[model samples]
Target: MNATGRQTDLIEDYVAALTAALHGPARVKARMIEEIRDGLADTAAAHTGEGMPYHRAAHQAVQEFGTVEELVPSCQQELTIAQARHTARAVALTAPFLIACWYLAQAADHGHAWLLPRTAQLLAVHLTGVATVAALLAAATLAATGALARRMPTPHRLPLVVAWAGTTASAAMAVTTLAFATVSALTTNWPLLAFAGTLAAASHAAVAASARACRRCSRLPTT
Candidate 1:
């Protein structure tokens, strides 16, 4: 085969091997592939300029990138962290919906009259309002966190940490409110309490799972 054909075959072989080894998010795989492709191309050109055949330069480039067997473990670890971060973000996004579910359960039990008591209704109203504000602020911060997947896992800082805190606090408060309401309704509206309690439990469970995942993701080097 010609020099150009040989070089193309080498590049294709290298890329195919790398791709087979990468079991990460599609975006990560694509990004890494592009980077490696350009890097190999550059390295090969440099070797060719130094009196090497194109195919020989390409061979050198492939060897330089390490074998697929060598790359898989490291790539898998990196992508696991990325997957964790992605999961945490998805959980956070569900917070508002979960919070709403809690309210709907309560409304179903008490009709509109359940919230008629000034103290009880006002308290839930205020807490939910706080949760809303916190959730909104947290969203802005959390959006930037996905960027971390491109780099390495580091201890979460700045907006991500703060955003997570806000979300955690909101979920806790919502659950607390649900608990109190459930307890008050235990005697007269036990059936309603059952319904409301179920939804609250679901919310709490989701929050717990999300928090745990985020904590794991936040710790630097989760490998």
Candidate 2:
């Protein structure tokens, strides 16, 4: 092979190793890997400018770029931040839809005069409040991860905090929604039960998904 081919092979091998060592959301990881590749290419080109052979320059660049072990921690930190952002955004967007579903269900129930019981009313209120809190926490997390991140210290802990807050809020909302659905099914007519139960199930599923994502983020190793 020509010197250029050998140089490309060496660089590709190093990048493959780096890719294997890291994990995260695909788009974020891919962008990071591309940036790394660009840096390596620039360094290699600089070495070649000083009269080194192409392959030798590539090898030197790879060596100077550091091992996967040394780089993985920083890369993982970025990936974790992306994941936290995704989880927070999911919660923020989904919460409002779920709240609207519950509202519609409540409205329908009220029209039937079936919402007379205080306990049912309380459960509906509790679920709505919990979902609202979760959405607000999610919004705060987005801000923390965005503009506030530049000003904040120990940014690694932010993801953990995001995970914990999201999980708790999602879990509370899911459980409360389940209870509300159970109450609706027992106390209302078949049509009302079907409507409420369907909405509740969708809401439960959405909250559970957010909770799972947050749980995974929480488990990520801190830098």
The candidate that achieves the highest lDDT relative to the unseen native structure: 2
lDDT of 2 by residue, 1-223 (tens): 8778888989998899888877666788899999999999999999989999888999999889887788877788777788778777867876775567566666666656654467666766776786788789789888888898889853656667667666765665566556556666666454655565565566556556655665565565646
* lDDT, model 1, position 125: 70
Deviating ranges (above 4 Å) for candidate 1: 112-223
lDDT of 1 at 207: 53
**What is the lDDT of every predicted structure here?**
0.60, 0.73
lDDT: worst 10-residue window of model 1: 214-223
Q: What's the TM-score of each model vs. the native?
A: 0.52, 0.77
Winning candidate number (TM-score)? 2
Candidate 2 least-lDDT 10 residues: 188-197
